[model samples]
Target: MPTTPRIADERHRYILEMLQEHGSCKVAELARTLAVSEMTIHRDLAHLARQNLLRKVHGGAVLRNYIELTFQDRAVQNHEAKVAVAQRAQSLVRPGTSLYLSPGSTTHEFALALIQDDLQIYTNSLPTATALARSAPQGLRVTLLGGELVVFVEALVGPATEAALADLRLTHAFIAVTGVSLEGGLTLYTEEEARVIRAVIRAARKTVLLTDASKFGQLVGPQVGHLEDVHVIVSDHIPDAYRQRCEQHDVEILLTADLDVMPTSAPGAAAADRRN
Candidate 1:
């Protein structure tokens, strides 16, 4: 049987799809499957690596799965605590203001909790945007930033996203981090994310970090900025060391337990229940 020929772009897409399904791909197998030369397969893998889509191994390529777990996977970790933190963060957001919501499981919860009418929100998380579109108040506006998609994180990032945020001023920036501490400050799993989140923090009048206890003292990737960049920290629990650090920096800490008693003004709570 004669093998059908595929263009370079189509071949690249097929290689990436295979990587996503199997986690890795051998150059020989890819060449045979795509009906291309081994050298051609190698070149395709190299191009994908340049795009930061996959990592090259000795004789094959693999997806960049080691950086962080997919968004759905991380969403299940500390679920209850994330909800509590989201509920508390919802209270601090006033109606009718522009805000930036960074991509993360916790910030996805925060997007679900928002009920404020006439609010303008810019975010890179596809799930967050979809959630708001399906359940947000009629007067709310959600803008999904345009950029390169990072499959594992389920967010759009890269230079295009940074340019979109370059001019806009936000009332608040609700951010989440993989790690937070006095020494590490706000750290994330990738430099791509760090660059975008740092822009968010700079654009807003106040930056509210929505995080849970699990991320309290851990250090992961590069630091986004110093703890001083954050104006408010909403968490389910905080270690005494961090609590003291927050105090020294005059950063206001809002514990979920303390704020949980307050009635939620967001209409999306019931909707969030249904979706869950």
Candidate 2:
């Protein structure tokens, strides 16, 4: 017999495999096939959903086709850069304010950074809630919004979650976007996820866009919002042209390093620095 923790982990993997192979599955059927209790299957589905592995439905789960990477695939990309971005994001949070975190790898890192703080966190990201629940200080309050669980991102969204967010106020919101275009603004792959992100932005007093250099100009889907919606843009590096665009929108850009001592006034020069 597997230990409890091991069983839980295996159950999660099994659920992911089932979704991958069949595109969907029923909860009760999954329980019967796996020889686990219905409650156990429910918990497993919830956990996998938090990782954005699949979307939980009325009776089972379905794979999110718009999201390209599996949970395992995302774990390996730019781990160090994500950590650096997470650390920078954490620096913006003060001790006892309410914060909202959107679902994404970079924002997940930011959630991890809040482990020692005494704060109130509201999120649709199951992974973020779990990370905060397990590691956040004792006095910290973590609220998981109600909605349809998106397995691919391990976050909740939909009418229910959006309704829940309507009553709450947040001091800060850290949004992880799939792509940032100078003209198209901030975009994401899924419309459902994009809606949730828009709610996060609206509920917060300050909105911070957290992304790495690679996310720039990579248009994935529709624009979630414009540069004007965000207060600060935090990235590893922003080319001169992009930086100027952000500045034009009254958005402050923070780069991890100083690219040049004598900064050129031309935004076009900044765009030219990209190394192919």
Q: How many pairs of residues in model 2 come into backbone collision?
A: 11
- Top model number, TM-score: 1
- Clashes per candidate, residues 3 or more apart or on different chains: 0, 11
Winning candidate number (lDDT):
1
Per-residue lDDT tens digits of candidate 2, residues 1-276?
543987778888887776555455678988899898887788888887888777676666666554556434664677778777777666567888988888888888888877556888888888778888777888888888999987776778899988877787888788888777766678765667777788777777778888888887665554578767887777887777787876665565655563322223343243222211
TM-score of each: 0.70, 0.67
lDDT against the true structure, per candidate, is 0.80, 0.73
- Listed per candidate, the RMSD to the true structure in angstroms reads 13.3, 14.4
Model 1 over residues 167-254: C-alpha lDDT tens digits? 8889888999987867657777677788899888767777888999998766555568877677778898888888777666667778
